[model samples]
Target: MDARDRDGPDRDGREADFTWGQARDFANQLIQAHSGKHLTDLEIKVLQGSWQNHTYEAMAEQYTYGAGYLNRDVGNALWKKLSQALGEKVSKTNFREALRRAWWQQGRSVPSVPPSVPPSVRPSVLPMTPPLPAVPLAETPFAEGPVAPQSPFYVVRSQVEDLGLRSLLKPGALVRVKAPSLMGKTSFLYYLLQGVQLQGYATIYLDLGSIDRDILTDLGKLLRWLCARVSRQLKIPNRLEEFWDSDIFGSNDNCTAYFEEYLLQEVPQPVVLGLDNVDRLFPHGAVVEDFFGLLRSWHERARISTLWQQLRLVLMHSTDVYIPLDYNQSPFNTGVPIELVEFSPDQIQALALLHHCSLDRPALAQLMAAIGGHPYLVRRALYELGTGSQTLGQLLATAATETGIYGAHLRRQWLLLQQNPALWQALIQVVQGTEPVSLSPLTLYKLHSMGLIHRHNNRVMPRCTVYRDYFRSMHRADSP
Candidate 1:
């Protein structure tokens, strides 16, 4: 055959099977060039498994992702991006040949992934061993707020934690942490901020939930609150009057100047500012646009300005931003987005052991069957068990009742639902249905944010058996 014909598929047929590693490197370059975003670890696993012809179910078993998430969420988005990059249709079934053709067209057989920098040559972004203090398992506390930095009960969420840390190390990084309430967003935020602080980066954490309603409604007051908080956290005097001139500069500009002129300059090291419960301001349309727009502008400024590069933002929220935003002016579109998921059975068991509440495999399974590895719920159960307040059986029996350990929590959720009839009805449909029920995006977002439901794609179900049973019983009690 001619040399030209030899470079075609017939040549690939005679060669060894294309290694997933090489395909991974090839696709990473292509996708990054096309989308300006690198493949995530989960996305990499999906690509690797597909290249090996492994089913999504098998991949899920071998990896941390769920089969449905692998198939529906990650896989669908990946294929579309690959199709755009390769200039042809790409799916799990046909990706192998498509990649092979692209491989030959590029005229390179070897992987193009860059070599890792040696420790000596690498930038000193993080310490080799971060000084994370250890808490004796027996002395670990069951605190209500974020887990202490030294707590042994803090179960390291390997994937999400690694991603967040790596993103923060980059100059001018923006890391968005989104999860339902009480799913340990605050706990994870503390863990992350502690890591950066130990690295010698100046860290400031502010929870927007603590901001008053009047301040949230007024742009100037909100900006002033933010400026004052950052200054106080940095041990600097409250100089909002010095930097902020509301009459001359707009609220956004005033906030930016406060950071650019004072906060960033005052801190000798890189500044990592984490804002928690950012969604608290979502209700005020005017504030949401201007505040988030300021954030987006700072992120963009980091790309070229050296002073702005010193600032990195970490935003922690419990739900999606439902309001409209300018496409070019929203920080959400850029930056590393993280969604905290429920814990695995293994993590739950490890935490139980830390609490010194040893239970057999079957007992642990029973607990998960009721609560499904919710971080706070699991911690609370283990805490109660550790305190000798209730037996495993007793806890399970009364879990859905008002007298149970989760009584206050369940009541708060019920109160929230009562305040919104539409949200209440939406959750009712999900709770009563045997299968996942569909709801409007806003309703689903609110329910998920409240930790009342779990969404698998467009459909949602009661987040746990506790919610399902509690809501169902409440409905029955109200029936005539």
Candidate 2:
């Protein structure tokens, strides 16, 4: 009979052709063969979840565990283990077929399709640690408040991970990180800096925000500060007098000369210069344009200049570059572009665990729905909950109010909305409904840049539940 021959009695003499036991047995065999090791307790549960084709969320509900981890983290780890074991690429979506192709060699090939779960019984045999019990609000995890930026609590998610261990040998390699305020732009840059250093590269960090306004007012003055900072960090003596030539060389050439002639020679390794808060330059028109243009000139130099090739750049900013820069002249347009986004539910749970919070899976989901995984907000919740400052329920309820934890931050944004009634009314559309509302492109850009909304295709929605609830409350109380 053909493989498709149908309507046969099952092992239990039922009409069904497949059973969970068959799928379980096949999956276990593949795991044992390809994983090079017996499946751990959690790994088996993960395999079962994948075999059943249950959404991580559905499986989490079944097993009472973190959906995010059970979905991707565990899946990724399992696939990685399989890939190593079988010397092949394996992922959750196709691991079964990959195994089937191998199993065919033994002449005991199981069916390619997974067995269907009967409507009646789905066993949740996953053995894992139960969620941490919520602590009292008074025992807040972060009694001192926000962890220092780039603290150990920073949890990296799979989606936002673009700066992997890839070689940066490409000359003039540039990376631009753009996101709205409080989106972890600074934190991401620090991580990149650390990665490069581990790769035996030297890094110089320049926070343009720290440059005095007076220095930025003059091109020569700012370049001098730049040279001084880089040289200082490099431990190279500042040879300012040796390179100064006001009439003979322009500021751009002068700065490049300082790096080429006097500074870089002291260093024997490639330099990764990480620039933070580039938005500070937008307001200073001539200064920003000329300075950015000078930076671009150096990037262009790498094609022919070995000295410049030794230099790499990482730029971080909080908004769209409304500065009207030319393509070749804007550093934002070139190099690998990455945008840090809000954390996913799984990443949030991982971070919560790092903070020593025992928040359950449902609580984690509810938290994400409320705050949308705003890096700062999610961390704040975990920190507070750990310190026993507020229960998860309490945090959600008081989130949008004037006296709430985010009161000051919400008030500042509310003021901006009040100043622009059009933006206020546009937000009203999003707040009043579950579906996203359409807005003009520039309008959407401006609103999203302010971290006020998130765009879905041509429509706009509040960035998170916190934003919607807070704004709604503010409209009733403050009318902003």
Candidate 3:
């Protein structure tokens, strides 16, 4: 018998002689061939662990280190080798795909293809061909699992570049990006910062999500933190100490005055300040108003300053917190409000390509339709598809249930609706009525701001079918 038959039959009864070392060597050879860099012993070990589909936590446990440490070390080591080989930096997450491709190259059995699309729902467009190269595994920087490539995490091209979002970084422009959780808000901000830096603008990314209402009570400290963060990011010399020693944080007015006079005016390059999760600052209106007013004041001063327009601000937030300023007057409202909508068909296709999935047009369309373009939902559905076991109908039904990413988000919203019956009533009226019921202006505004309903043709409408059905079910169950 051949060596393959001598070893044993795989679960499928096919002759196989696959061993752990064989898998490692196969992965190494593939990396060498594609990446042109030799893997270190540590990297090979990590790759072997990864090839076995071990979690970072598990790897850490095996190595007696923290998961984060193992992840970072392995990630950095992989990135170093990939950069040396490819002559460009490859992100940590994409490395997983490289390993998968290596397995395929080694004559190992490939995962089964997903079932064919139903004839009734075939796509109008032809299938995308393989001429488009697969995104090298080492280049993707997100985590690996059976996630759909169409998910937001997969759609992130790299840390420093995303052509779709580059325009938001123009000097002195205001931009607002909104999405629900796991839609890649933080990742997008990182990309935007990288983009702005490439354009010779300085960037400071602040996560206001961690700040509380009490922080707003001390506006001086807030401004000081902002100034120091900007200074450090820009490599401005001793910026925090300079501001502190100069008494910038002594009082609210002192901080604002110093920001307008020194940091804003004296900065060497155009500044792009990204305030992520700005909704946390909203509960303290005084702080929010003051902080934004400082930005507006500096923006006006920018036109007259000897330096180029000095500063721009981008605010990222979820739908929970509302910004009460009028669009025309507010700095965030003045420039452009770009709602990072759900993934487009092309983006989803890009994801499939990245994951090396053989998704045809009809299959792609069916996936998008079921998820309603929500990013996390799309990812979860694509993940299910990647497994090549579940049916499209099963994936679609799960997309609506509470088990997948989309379902979890829906459950959160459903629970919120249950807590606030007025909100529930408002949603029901908007969904079931042919004409928009005239809700109290405050209620209408609040719901719209919360993303529960959207205005269309002077009428409020429910945001999604899931929400509509939720209220409909409640309404029916209550009927007696």
Candidate 4:
């Protein structure tokens, strides 16, 4: 008997034979076959949540886990594993369709055809493709937070990573990774920390961006928080009281003594401390100088003190260091500076292929022309295209519109600009002007850090065609 005889399309004339329970079972089977292990409880929650179109934040609220841990750490690995098992690209947004196609391919159910259609003209549930080699669709996991160290989607900039690792291994090393927002600076640091760990070093990765504003403003609280976090990562007992004395020592001195007497001494191997989004502290005028100056002191001491040499620092930030400090007290100028640049065309092609998007040279060129090899933007485009949801032409056609794949990101940039009239006007000039526009140094830095415009020498232009087109259209619409 034909599958259509048992299960037919719903009233809407679309197939309704597939269900979420069936999807879960199919996923379980594929995952078990691939990993020889069953899904965890949290994994099931994510699977169910994704099936219901629930965002990671929603899942976290419902299930009581950190959204970052669920999305970046768990969701990233889960989708990649599922993609590998299914031999097709899978993500939270597209997994439903992917599973439906897979189920239909397994002869589970045929899509119900309309009786009006001719007997010989019935369509298959999905288009058939050639039996090609399985792509590492897992490598191209969803581009959330920082790209996981295990992801193949990470494109290494030329020799920059090697320089970072080399610098990280040196005694008293200070490696600074600076890039505009979404340029993969954090992802690079993730990989760098992994590499350092493999070399018998104790590694601690912290994202200062997530620190609370209240703690940020208080020097004493911030120092204690930093020490407590480091101790936790190192699995050592927190002894801040024994080392900290407000009347006897300044916050910086207390922080130093805690590290020198406690953290540095507890670990047998050298320690590589990775501080991501360190610029988060920049707004706290009182805390920023003392904290950074302390780091500078540590780096200087490392030159002569073996105990201090055991500590290596990796600071990653998305902005220029505009805060003033005495020349000898600043840590920014003395390190191996690794500034991440936008992905090159070849690099973008490599990442696209990882996402199973075998875009041809011309198609790749078209994408580059629109987005200019921005890592996050390029990955997002490939992800959408790989899902078989839209053609390259369709994506590019809707690229600058609010309904397109990049709509949320574009809207976020717009909202941020709208909050600051000066930044808003500055961006307008860059987007509308035929030649590169000159702006104040601070204004230029802010725009560049926001990833809205590219800086060439001292002049600026809209980062890419997408920004140029979207902002230009918005400017026109907002005008008389």
Model 2 residue 120 CA deviation in Å: 12
TM-score of each: 0.67, 0.69, 0.60, 0.68
Model 2, range 159-190, lDDT digits (tens) per residue?
Answer: 34435223243456777778876677777777
lDDT of each: 0.76, 0.67, 0.57, 0.77
Best by TM-score: 2
- Clash pairs detected, candidate 4: none
The model with the greater lDDT, 3 or 4, is 4
**Of candidates 2 and 1, the better by TM-score:** 2
- Model 4, residue 340: C-alpha shift (Å): 1.2
Model 4: per-residue Cα lDDT at residue 221: 91
Residue runs of model 2 more than 4 Å from their true location after superposition? 1-151, 164-169, 320-332, 478-480
Clashing pairs in 1: none
* Native-referenced Cα lDDT, model 3: 0.57
**Candidate 1 structure quality by residue, lDDT tens digits, 1-480:** 442322223443522334554467557657855775556656777887776667999998997569998899989999999999889998988887787777655534332222365555543232111112233555767747787644556666668887997799789999998876788889889878877775678999999998889999998889888898989999988778787787887888888898888888888898999999997877677788788888989999999998999899999877533323222332356799998988877567556655666665568768988998888898889888877778999999999989998998888788767777767777778889999988887677667767778878878888889999999888888779
In candidate 4, stretches whose alpha carbon ends up further than 4 angstroms from where it belongs are 1-140, 320-331, 440-442, 456-458
**Clash totals for all models, in order?**
0, 14, 8, 0
lDDT of 4 by residue, 115-146 (tens): 68875666533211111222565544666677
> What C-alpha lDDT does candidate 4 achieve relative to the native structure?
0.77
Question: Superposing every Cα of model 3 onto the true structure, what RMSD results?
Answer: 14.6
Best by lDDT: 4
TM-score leaderboard ranking: 2, 4, 1, 3
